[model samples]
Target: MLTKKNSFSILAIGAVVASSLVLFINSTKKQESALPPARPNIIFIFSDDHTAQAISAYGSKLTKTPNIDRIAKEGAILHTNVVTNSICGPSRATLLTGKYSHLNGYKLNEKVFDVNQPVFPEELQKNGYQTAWVGKMHLGSLPNGFDYLNVLPGQGHYYNPDFINSKNETVRYPGYVTNVVTKLSIDWLNQRDTSKPFFLVVGHKATHREWLPDAPDLGAYDNVNFPLPPTFYDDYTGREAAKDQDMTIDKTMRLKEDLKVHADYEKSGIFNRFTPEQKKPFYDYYENKISKEFDAKKLTGKALVEWKYQRYIKDYLSTARSLDRNIGELLDHLDKSGLAKNTVVIYASDQGFYMGEHGWFDKRFIYEESLKTPFVIRYPGVIKPGTQINELISNIDWAPTLLNLTGTTIPRGVQGESFLPLLTGKKVAWRKEAYYHYYEYPQPHHVYPHFGIRTDRYTLARFYEVKDFWELYDLKNDPQEMHNLYGSKGYEAITADLKAKLKKEIIHYKDDEALKIMESKL
Candidate 1:
């Protein structure tokens, strides 16, 4: 009953319908591919007392931090990333609030960080990002900005450390602290809300004081005899505060506790926390090998000091080895999980530490070694590979930059201006100088409370409270800060100009105590 013309017309109509459906599907696929990710994921890999001198990216001869260097090679590195306060607790507080020590009300390590205050991660949460802080957050109180919080209690032990979770339960994880922290971080990343972007602070307790390396990294740098810094025997002739300080490689760094000279494996201390399996490698390395060699030498005077320096370097670098390796592991996880394309990885330290510079170990002084910290960041699409930013940057800028990167609003009362524009190759007016203030004193290292300003070519500081003396150094000429130019006859005009700028900065920061002391000195 069907005609030949009717059947041909129906077949032609069916072919046209099929072609239209294919075009529509291809268009939708193109549209989806064109859209960029809503927000970038951020991973801030933070460490304690990791000096630029130890990071290979920062031209360090001490050690090769390949994983840390990878960040610098991929993105940008800050040449002058300075701290507002050169201590651990206050530095972390500044990173959180984007404010100085006086403004944040966390000026010392003994005090508690006020978690009720607003933080950048809180802003991220409001903007549809999942936030977490894993590892050593030494702020003395539970964190508030994070959705997932698993952190070390105090200065976390190097081996088999305990992590206080969000449930407020102290759970002991049996592994080296660095590896454990990374594993916990990876676990959080895996278990997190994958639909949303994540902001994670992977805090590490590596390379801190009493440096304890991982078991496999026991004698990593035993053969490498590190060269002493040129200013190692600094006499502290003009600097009164430097002379009175007790934190020296020659004196303060302990024999048994720091260098592990005849360290008791059976003793009830940090070692006791370690399981017998964990103690074997450490005991064998330090006691059976290092301790025996040290005892046999019976080194004295300069020889003994140099020997101690070598041991300290070996232990510290070994500790840092684990830190770097763990970083590599974390990076591998991101790459494997396909998170590398949209994740911004940042590596920085709480503060810089002296590696036998000025014959010192602790970080309290407002010198070049302690004042400046290493900051390297990798953002795959945004930041160009191998970019070097020489602009003067402060740690206070951390929060603001992170906020801006995520397209989040920087809250009011946040002092730091975002350096995000720098990453995007935009020409903007940046800070010409950086301000620094150190408050802890007398008890820990006796560095004496001080406030200072570091310009492109000069560093002007007033050591107050106990010793009301001023120290100025022309950093261009005296890179080692050996010559004090505060009261020198030839540089009166520059000194006056720097003092005026310092006063202006102190007042602008609204640090009443610093202003009062500065005014009194004037």
Candidate 2:
């Protein structure tokens, strides 16, 4: 009924309206896209010889770690653990590259790592992230790929520690190692490129061997009498291989190896003639009541051994107290700076240490004390608060997970898988088991070099250097790993199956040298 011109005008008007609507929708999308996605600032705090059992959040009754506990309280606590090579240098190398010691070309303490090799920091930097590393990085070679690096040089001294900066210049900083490291980390955080995302690694030299605390913390646990571990006096009977090791707290540890007591030797009227340095060694010899009593009563042999255990626990926990306080300082910094909401905070140790467990102090064996490192992660907004994950994980997985969170691609030849899905509560399938390898052997502590696979239900281990031994523990039944069921009549099938899986893993990792030695021994 309408005229042809009128109908044409109507069609033209409809087209114009449709075009305007499309433009309006496109403009709204552009405004949304212009706003930046909230990328997190990651702060990874690592400690020396901090065992999971020492953390109160992990249900440790020995001491409370309130600051470290903050991370677990706000994020996920990973119960299942990983350590590719348990020694300090190797473990650190594994962390940097997400690869095993062999793959990273840093197998032992003295061995140097290739700086040219790819590391997680480099990848982060490439993706527009500002990276900084402060404190104890025990890798034999100097650090690379970091925008700012202030690291200790070779197990740096506790007092007046020397920190090597990125310019290859070393400067001495006064104060306890832990406190200085935390301060430097906070300084780095304040001065970083705010426009870009940042990744900071704050490494603390705490709770290490020869435990020494700040003067104020010296008397922290002086009043509390620590309860003896159930296996404190274990004879190591039926476990000849483990018994023969030299990691016992009683015999192997030295009094002079850890404590301090008197300020002025001569003024104290005890070893008065000795100089401060000369008297310092003596303080280690006789600080604790048991040690003093042993010396006063002239206790010998077995009686002397009993006295050492009591002294070791008190001093170790005192040092741990100082570590907790320093961590609290850093946590406070994040909160005050308004960074807590957008920061990803993590607290972990290089490897777990023995606190009189199996009557041992050092970590090297595939036992639970050495195998489980404490790991707690807090990613605001992304991770559910107060989450706890018992699934197996490794230090190697750290790199991939961080990369994934930053929306970066994980490179080839990395051994660890991305755990971001687990962190975000996504229902993605993850690894069921973890592999562990310790290469230091026939050396310190005399713990034989070993490799093993650990599953939820069992642990399968092989000690290659000594007797080609095989040890299997039914974790469900023997949580403490008191018994070895490798050749037991009732568990023959179980052992056989684990052995097959172990061999397959070794082959999969392409540890040709290890495989060759294993095959020759077989």
Candidate 3:
């Protein structure tokens, strides 16, 4: 039993088994290394009233957004990111809940967002991630699902704005709103728990209504006399609601409040919120130069409207300058802090705004200018540089996409599916059309509440409430949408098809109000 050959054979078998185990361990290590990180940090920079038409990455001719364009250059840009409800609070609600406005219960501004409902950030918390929302949360209620929050009380001012912190105490921050927001966001990032990943929303208040540029940014585009849009003097031929809207540049945009004409810097208004030194640049620019020029010109009729247009464009773009600069500062911080490689940086707006489109100033209609918002994102080692997606995407899909990116389970209540596969260059089934609805009405802009559907080459909407009418446009043949083709001869089939799709989408979204309107009104 103790032969020399038998002992040697047993030893050889043991050596072979040891070698196979070592090879298996090495292979397992290699596979684990090939996988993505366990969790990636996310930084979503949301700006208010920033339209795609103002961002250079979207091929804007009026302004050059070099900083925002950096995201598109480094990763991917979406050309057709539509909002479910093209308003402020509704869009943000959809983004947070991955549901349409009706389902989220925030179809309008000036209302409390239901914090009891689940948000993506809350899901992130359960999955071992820290969440924070800093700056310009316009939702009236105190926010939940965040470990830290310092948001604007309402539509925070351009200079020396007050921030409501997590304790619900209002603290005034002394500086431009955009810069303060960025500083607060960075401060939180620096102090956050390093062991866990983070989700932060850097909300910027620049380019909102009253369009006040920062002190140094005054007169930034003085030399550039922006050309008028092709539909500058849009004659509402067949469109009844367009004719009644009060948001035209010639009518609704005020001289004293909106354009800062003849504004008293020392008076108790927006300027009074500023300190003496803070008001200096505004007074020096508007009072001494702009107001004096206006008095001398005494413009009237078309000349007056055109002058207002130029002033509005200049002020809006000038205000946006600070926003872009702050974005650069945030990007640089990420690079220096070694978070650039693992963090997902995204830039999007609440909803698009009109810059003289159809001679309008505000956004409430389901038109292209208001429906389409800007969305660009950078994900290192995942999305290749200079990727452009033209698929139909909705703001509701934003939450699900973020959840998918962090490897979290998307909740069933969330109606939108993730667009992560599209970003990763995967071929998948995608939506061919997008649904849109707008409900705010009768007060501010007087834009009629409407619901519609948009396919690749066509847009069909039915305006209700104040006025009941159907409008359809072939976006391919008439990109400007100047011609209405709803009841035109030879277009019966197109109208019926779009209406059927619109009905199907309404039922799918479970919008009972829209369904009733469709049945009774249409």
The lDDT for every candidate, in the order shown, is: 0.91, 0.80, 0.91
Residue pairs clashing in model 3 are: none
Model 1: runs farther than 4 Å from truth? Answer: 1-37
- 1-522, model 3: which lDDT tens digit per residue? 878998999889989999989999999999999986768899999999998889999999988889899999999999999988888878888888999988888988989999888888889998999999999888888756899999998898888999999999999999889999999999999999999999999998877989999888999999998999999999989888889999999999999888999886666467778888988889889989999999999999999999999999999999998899999999999999999999999999999999998998878787889888999999999999999898999998999999999988899999898999999899999987798888888877888999999899899998988878899999999988888999999999999999999999899889898899899945
Question: What local lDDT score does residue 519 receive in model 1, on the 0 to 100 scale?
Answer: 81
Alpha-carbon lDDT of model 3: 0.91
In terms of lDDT, which candidate is stronger, 1 or 2?
1
Of 2 and 3, the candidate ahead on TM-score is 3
Off by over 4 Å in 2: 1-22, 30-36, 260-294, 301-303
List candidate 3 segments past 4 Å from native: 1-17, 20-27, 30-36
Clashes of each: 0, 2, 0
Q: Which pairs clash in model 1?
A: none
Superposed by TM-score, candidate 1 places the C-alpha of residue 211 at a distance from the truth, in angstroms, of 0.5
Worst lDDT run of 10 residues, candidate 2, spans 261-270
**Predicted structure 2, TM vs. truth:** 0.90
Q: In terms of TM-score, which candidate is stronger, 1 or 3?
A: 3
Using TM-score as the measure, which candidate wins?
Answer: 3
